[model samples]
Target: MHDSVWKFVCLRDLQVPAPCQVAFKWIKLYGSLADGSHSYKIRNNEKHIDWMRIGAFFFDSPVAILSEKLSLPLTILNKDNVEKALESSGACVLSNIKRGIWIADLQLVRCPVCELDTCEGTMQTLEVRNIELFLCDEYQKGSWDYELIGSYTINKSVDAASGGIFDLKHIKDRAMAGVFNLKSWAGKPSDMQPKAMITFHSVAIRTNLQENQGLITKYYAMRAGFEGEVVSIRISQQLA
Candidate 1:
């Protein structure tokens, strides 16, 4: 399999909420590292929740809306049509795509170089190998809102007659935050051929339970809505 395939696999196993939190925290803490980490700040008062973080999760959401359901031809993802997407509601794409939290394992090693079929070169070659990896909240986007609501966290409890506590506990919690969706861009739909359709998988949710007094909250989801062709070219060193 290609390295990218394994990369997606590593990304798929990440647990939700925790991975989401880790991704959000990493971005908030390091997004400005290349420019200046200090330039970025976590907004939304400590008491309020952060919506930008919620938006980030929508970046590469696995969620998608079938074109058949939307009754529209598929849109494409290319340089030209992407602009049309910005103006039309034909398809929805994540905005401000940013790298999210990631975990990877890599190795550095030395190899041999050949000068001729039967001779060795005077220099050594170095190659890097990447393997066995996992990532959580690697990409996200979208906006969120804070609002008041009733929620509950399940817990094990004891049966009164049994005189023994259950292994779980059930608790109710509430809070508020704005909710947003992956929406079709606003304008006339474009006609750019796109490759394989995109959507989200291994879904999950993330939230600040402490503020909600221990409420179970879920992360909003977004899905793509477009149809077209996507082509990839690989330049080879040899003609086959």
Candidate 2:
């Protein structure tokens, strides 16, 4: 099995507004499922209750998404070539046209170390104390799976000197300072025209927390909107 690590950003700190409502869609492509017929399916499900937080990072890579759903083994296919084939088919081509946060009503819970009240109806918010980067590895000889490898947290006094507002630039810069090897992992490939691909969307929130705690706390406390796209792609040399 091959392992690959990826870096992700929370973009801006997020918070739960009212009733939590975060959603995700999973799309799968079946290439000639033993009948020489092509088919695809889309699933819209709510995010896990424990994951609905402001500063949580998730696996948003295309390789991770494709590896998680495909059941039957198929030959490796290039993404660019797949797109060209769909365009030539004359059918309606669907792709990720819009990026960035679409919704922001994700629910959040306090850290276990903190002595926050659970019964209080007051809105609870949490900051990303440390980001646990996800590592994707090949599983079951053909499928891809993910796990947490390591994490990095910002030092409020060292990183943010001025201490007025948490700098988004500084946070991202620190998060991506290290290098990761992408050549060790495999990518999606198909023998037939792929019917679907996965796309990731983000959601930002405004919180009512305080700013004097620390870097993460202050950042989430201050109501500021930041926007950027954090995406990466890796192709496999081997074929199925």
Q: Pick the candidate with the highest TM-score.
A: 2
Across 1-240, the per-residue lDDT of candidate 1 in tens digits comes to: 554453344444332122343322233233222221110122212222111111111212322211101222234223344335423632222222222322111111111222244432111101000110111121112122121211123232211100000000000001000111113311122322111111121111111111111212111121121221111001001000
User: Can you tell me which runs of candidate 2 are displaced by over 4 Å?
Assistant: 1-105, 114-150, 157-200, 205-209, 216-240
Cα miss at 110, model 2 (Å)? 2.9
TM-score of 1: 0.19
Model 1 stretches astray by more than 4 angstroms:
1-12, 15-72, 75-79, 90-94, 101-240
> Candidate 2, residues 42-112: lDDT per residue as tens digits?
11112112223222233322111111111111121223344344234321122221222222123333332
